[model samples]
Target: MKIWSSEHIFENPWELVVRAQWRKYPNKFNQAVEGIDVVDRQIDSKGVLRSHRLLSTRWGIPDWATKIIGSDGVGHASEHSAVDPRNKTMELKTRNLTFCSKITIDEKLVYSPHPEDKNKTCLKQEAVINVKGVPLGSYIESFVCDHISKNASKGREAMDHVINTIKLETVELQKEAKHAMESINLNFDI
Candidate 1:
């Protein structure tokens, strides 16, 4: 078994960081994540939004590991998340569904406003890995943990790209709306 944890701070506001997280897929930075499907979503009585998602991913496993596992490296994981707007907090938990007999990876993440800077967001992440019935289990666990650390950096880059895209889209929409208003005013003046 291996445990890994990390903390990071994003310069963007908490709301924008959380928003970017929802749209983090399909970006150039994290190509390993192939797809995401929302399985369920709802709002609770206290106004917290809850969501369950299934993620399809290819982790770029080594050739030797693939040979040992006797299968393609493609995998699926189920994620459950909760967002509390009132408190400006987002929490997510994910667990692998594939290769359960040989290995299991469980992850947890939390996003919240930075205590020192309200405009910044702080992310806390932890992952646990266990390998059963596998040779060199400890080595495999260490490799997975290292891969996760690298992927976490890519995840941040992806979030930055998403946030930039969102800002650009917002600006474009505003310009379009302004143009429509001007056109309507011109028609009225005629």
Candidate 2:
């Protein structure tokens, strides 16, 4: 078993970060994630947005697993996400479904507002992996742990890009609103 953790501080607020997260996949920085199909989406009783998705992904792994397992390295992952605007937090969990017990991997992520800096958000990532079905389980687990750590950092960079895009859109909208307001003329009837 291997457990790994990573953290990043995003320049955007939690609200913007969470919005970016929902559209993070399939971006330029994360080409490993090929597709996502939403299985379920709804608002919980507490008004939190909950969603379940099937994700198809392929990433770098040791060549031996492909030979020993007799299967391609593509991974079909199940992902669940929850966004609680009231609590100003977002949580996501994902696990691999293809290998199951042979090479199981589970990841959890939490996004929250930074305590000291309201404009910044903190993303905490954690992953647990097990590869006991293979002869070199220990070595494989270590390799996977390292890969996950590196992936976490790349994921953060992708999210930052998403948030910046949102910010640009917001600025454009504000500009339009300001222009419209300037053109409006109020006439007094009385």
Which candidate achieves the best TM-score against the true structure?
1
lDDT of 1 by residue, 1-190 (tens): 9999999999989999999999998889879889899999999999999999999998788789788867688899999999999999999999999987888999999999999999899999999999999889999899899999999999988988898998999899999999999999999999
lDDT of 2: 0.88
On a 0 to 100 scale, what is the lDDT of residue 187 in model 1?
100
TM-score of each: 0.94, 0.89
Give the per-residue lDDT digits (tens) of candidate 2, residues 84-163. 99999999999999878789899999999999999999989899999866888999899889888877777888988888
Clashing pairs in 2: none
Model 2: per-residue Cα lDDT at residue 64: 93
Per-residue error for 52 in candidate 1, Å, reads 0.9
Error of 1 at 183 (Å): 1.6
